[model samples]
Target: MPDLNWQKSSFSQQASSCLYLAAAPDGTVKLRESDNPDVILTTAPATLGALIRGIKAGEFDHIRTA
Candidate 1:
């Protein structure tokens, strides 16, 4: 984490509430919100790709609207 280059979430325009992402040398993707950098979520690239595809396909809409 200390050596990782954290990047802001493209979906958020404001830096204050933005999310940060990084990739470890081991190839694991990491995510954390700028507001709470202490917490991190790690996942593989393939798994993250699938989740993004699902989101674009509206597979998770019910979780918010229901």
Candidate 2:
């Protein structure tokens, strides 16, 4: 993978802690934390789109952290 242009989400906090996204050359998407760019997660564009839609639909609202 070549250099990626990362963009922070609008919902991200003003603090340094945030997530960034970039579109891969092959049309896939990449995700990583702004504070830790070394660790990255890549996924298909369709999958990422579905996840965003699900989030908008509240599909993950039931998730709880201990």
Candidate 3:
């Protein structure tokens, strides 16, 4: 994958491990974290939108790990 015009969230601090998103030419969404830039995750726009909606609805709030 070539260098993309990744954009960080406005709520993120200047030097924090922020989430970055970019739209690929192929219409897919690219996601990566500032702490681990090499590991990129690609997904469809609709699926990403659903995930965001779920997040906003607090659907994943109950998730916990031991």
Question: Which candidate leads in lDDT?
Answer: 3
Candidate 1 per-residue C-alpha lDDT over 9-62 given as tens digits, one digit per residue, 9 for 90 to 100: 578888879888788898999999878888999999999999999999999887
Give the residue spans of candidate 3 off by over 4 A: 63-66
TM-score of each: 0.81, 0.80, 0.87
lDDT of each candidate versus the true structure: 0.87, 0.89, 0.91
For model 3 the TM-score comes to: 0.87
lDDT for residue 57 in candidate 2, whole number 0-100 = 100
Clashes of each: 0, 0, 0
Mind giving the per-residue lDDT tens digits that candidate 2 earns over 1-66?
Answer: 798998987888764799899998898899998778899999998999999999999998896879
Q: Is candidate 2 or candidate 3 better by lDDT?
A: 3
